[model samples]
Target: MSLEVLLDTNTCIFILNHRPPQVAERFAEHPIGSIGVSSITAAELSFGMHKSGSEKNLERLKHFLTPLAVLPFDDEAARVYGRVRAELQARGTPIGPLDTLIGAHALALGATLVTNNTREFKRISGLALEDWL
Candidate 1:
């Protein structure tokens, strides 16, 4: 509960009802702390929930993200995104677009990314990430 975090999209879904997620406790850290989400994740979650047609699940998601500090997908984030993407690619390690963008947002907020995909994220230099698992 000591570290404030920005959740990766997968982890955010767990916030709704996945009790066994190792990082669920991290969300409690931010009852007052801002839980940052990438715009891509917001969209992905909305799409999944929409397709699932679970009003209860959708409500839970809204409540989960409606509060807390948000890092909007903006021009500044785009600049960082390009820089990070190029840097990673130059190193011959390519990550998914969503992950690259999420890492950028996490860096923008100076918060550690809470994710289980540590191996992929660790490749980016200077980008701080944590394994919720």
Candidate 2:
């Protein structure tokens, strides 16, 4: 059975920059299904790309994500963010606010979250965390 890995923001960047073999290997491990990317990840990438002053790289990033399914910051996701945050706080998981939001989106979509930063996100009980670190 293949897993629908929701590419985390950091792993997404690493995969896009061609800097990590682990991310690619993970894809190969579960390629039969599809990949999911969050818009929050795109915002993070755009912010970083803008800081680097590389329009070409930004274009490349856009093209890279064009084929993946996008998990938008929709109302349902926002609602899940609140619930996920409450659950995490109650469970003593101190992930950063942004990561919480991203993980919540993955949870709402029922997709396994693929990331390098697992410690923070693993705190949320239902977040299927897969590390590519």
lDDT by residue (1-133, candidate 1, tens digit) is 2325778877777666766565677676566654677777787888988999989878877887787555577887788888999999998998988899888877766678887788888876777787666
Off by over 4 Å in 1: 1-3
**Ten-residue stretch with the least lDDT total in model 2:** 24-33
- What local lDDT score does residue 81 receive in model 1, on the 0 to 100 scale? 83
Candidate 2: Cα lDDT at 126: 84
TM-score of each: 0.85, 0.87
What TM-score does structure 2 among the candidates reach? 0.87
- Count the clashes in each prediction: 0, 0
Per-residue error for 96 in candidate 2, Å, reads: 0.8
> lDDT score of model 1?
0.76
